[model samples]
Target: MSDLRDLYQELILDHTKRPRNFGQLATANRKAEGFNPLCGDRVTVHLELDGDTVREIHFEGSGCAISTASASLMTEAIKGLRVEDARALFEQVHKLVTGASGPNGGGPSLGKLVVLAGVRDYPIRVKCASLPWHTLCAALSGGDETVTTE
Candidate 1:
């Protein structure tokens, strides 16, 4: 378990220093901004949907390691998935970060996002980590306003 935690930590740090898909999507058709007022983490999620499939996804923002990594991993996870699948993935990730004891013996089946499971231990940091996800939700729903984790 300690080794797994270490790997998670390393993965988070790696994403923090160099997040994946960390830029604006010039061709994005959907976009939403997110902010975690408690932790001051801000993020913007951009998506390009072709029919029901996510043709592309991207994000730009400034926040803690968990926030950045969550956004990065989210892009990787949701690409090529249908809108419904993306929403399901979002729910899975939300459950993971919210400390829900999932089927994997308390660990959610979020794949790379499992690294963020530890964030639940830090209540405040959970907001930081979830900011981008909520933004993604808003973007999917065609929301134009900024989403806030109040």
Candidate 2:
């Protein structure tokens, strides 16, 4: 329990137990749906953007601990960041969880997201860590409710 996992244990567990943005945002102007057919983890992300910044976010999903926790953290992380920054953060998580580290050790900007790096050790769980990012991209791009991931 002395590892970085210890540092983020509360963070990840809290998110999983009471996942943030875990509902449908009534005010969302953009929304996207994501599903992991392999694991049957499904979610719909609702986003409210104030120009380039995300003013609010919400989601509803059925997934494993990793997916739920990642979504919770993703919502909190992108609160005030610009769209570009959020996109960068998504890429960071993707690389980190997939074991293909990005430049600068793969997450210089996303501090706690690094906690999920252990997800790389489990290939199946990697998708759980990435679901939110895919949904985020769909929402940002004004896509209709239909996006999928592995």
Candidate 3:
């Protein structure tokens, strides 16, 4: 268990130091901004949808390691997924990080995103970890107002 935790920590730090898909997408058709006032984390999620599938996704922002890594991992996870699938994935990840899913809940595997499950241990950090996901939801829903974790 300790080894697994260390691996998770390493993965998180890797994503934080060098986030994947971190940039603006010139061809993005949908975008949304998010702010976490609790920790002053801000992020913008951009997406290019090919019909109902996400053809590309990117994000740009300055935030805590958790926020940045979550955005990075999210973009990687959702890039080739259909919008509906991505939304479902968001729900799964939300449950994982928020401790809403109990042991043996048997949720679908989150793959690389399972690393985020650790955030549930830190109540306040939960907001930091979820900021990007909330922003992605806004972009998917075509919301113009900035999403806030207040």
Candidate 4:
């Protein structure tokens, strides 16, 4: 499993060094901002919907490598999905990172997101890694401006 661990590390580093969909949508239908005070990670997710489908998704923020990369990958994952599907993704990802249902509960299927699972071993980093997903949930939930750990 050492090889797999290295692979996961590489994946996380890649996402951090070169984030995907890291920008802002000119006309976003939905938007949300999240802050992880534990690690001082902050981010904003913006989405443009085209007939219930996310035609565009983007992000702008400053955070740890894990947080930034997570947001970057999140934008890519949810771009083509509907709002509801995106919401489901948020819950799925939340459980994945928190190990709420135990290891491999739902994280292994999260693609690059699974790389972040190692973060569970580090309690403080858990909030860092989860920042993006929290922002996403807030963005999609509507009628909410903030979703915090506090």
Candidate 5:
């Protein structure tokens, strides 16, 4: 368990230092911003949808390591997925990080994203970790208003 935790930590740090898909997408058709007032984390998610599938996704922001890494990992996870699948993933990840998952455990395969589940141990930081996901949700729903974790 300790080894697994260390690996997760390393992965988070790697993503934080070199976030994947971190930039603006010139071809983006949808975009949304998110803010976590408690931690002062802000992020914007951009998406290019080819029909119902995400052809490309990107994000740009300055935030805590958790927030940045979550955005990075999220972009990687949802890039090729259909919009509905991405939304479902958001729900699963929300449950995982909020400790709201059922006894069956992690509640489906979140792959590398499971690393973020550790944030649940730190109540306040949960908002930090989930900030990007909320922003992504807003983008998917075509909401222009900024999502806030208040």
Candidate 6:
């Protein structure tokens, strides 16, 4: 268990140190910004949808390691998925991080995202980890307003 925890920590650190898809997308057709007032995490999610598929996705933001890594991992996870699939994934990730379900408890198969399950132990950090995901929802739904976790 300790070894697994160390691996999870390492994964999070890796994504934080060098986040994936951390930039603006010139061709994005949908975009949304998110702010978490509790921890001052802010993120903007951009997407390019080809029909129902996400042809491209990117983000730009400044936040805690959790927030950064979550955004990074999120972009990677949802890139090739359809818009509706991406939305379902958001719910899965939300449950995974919030302890509504566990990796072995018949939750959505999180794959690389399982590393974030430890976040459930630190309730406050859940907001940090999920900031980008909520922003993604807003982006996908075409909501121009900034999503906030108050």
* TM-score winner between candidates 1 and 2: 1
Error of 3 at 117 (Å): 0.6
> 1-150 in candidate 5: lDDT tens per residue?
885463359899999999999999999999999998776789999999999999999999999888999999999999999999999999999998888985333644799888888887777788888899999999999999999997
Q: What range of 10 consecutive residues in model 2 has the weakest lDDT sum?
A: 1-10
Best by lDDT: 5
Per-residue lDDT, model 5, residue 117, is 80
1-150 per-residue lDDT for model 3 (tens digits): 885473359889999999999999999999999998777799999999889999999999999888988999999999999989999998988888888986433155688888887787777788888899999999999999999998
Clashing pairs in 6: none
Scored by lDDT, model 4 comes in at: 0.78
Please give, for residues 2-110, the per-residue lDDT of candidate 6 as tens digits: 8547335988999999999989999999999999987778999999989999999999999998899999999999999998899889998899888888545224467
Pairs that collide in candidate 1 are none
lDDT of 2 at 6: 36
- Evaluate model 2: give its TM-score: 0.88
lDDT of 1 by residue, 1-150 (tens): 885473359888888888998898888999999987777788999999898988999999898777898899889989899999889888888887887755342343567788887787777677777888899999999989999998
The digit string of per-residue lDDT tens for model 2 on 53-143 reads 8899888888888888899888888878889988988887888888789434474677877777777767767888898889989999998
Question: Candidates' lDDT values, in order?
Answer: 0.84, 0.83, 0.88, 0.78, 0.89, 0.88
TM-score, every prediction = 0.90, 0.88, 0.92, 0.86, 0.92, 0.92
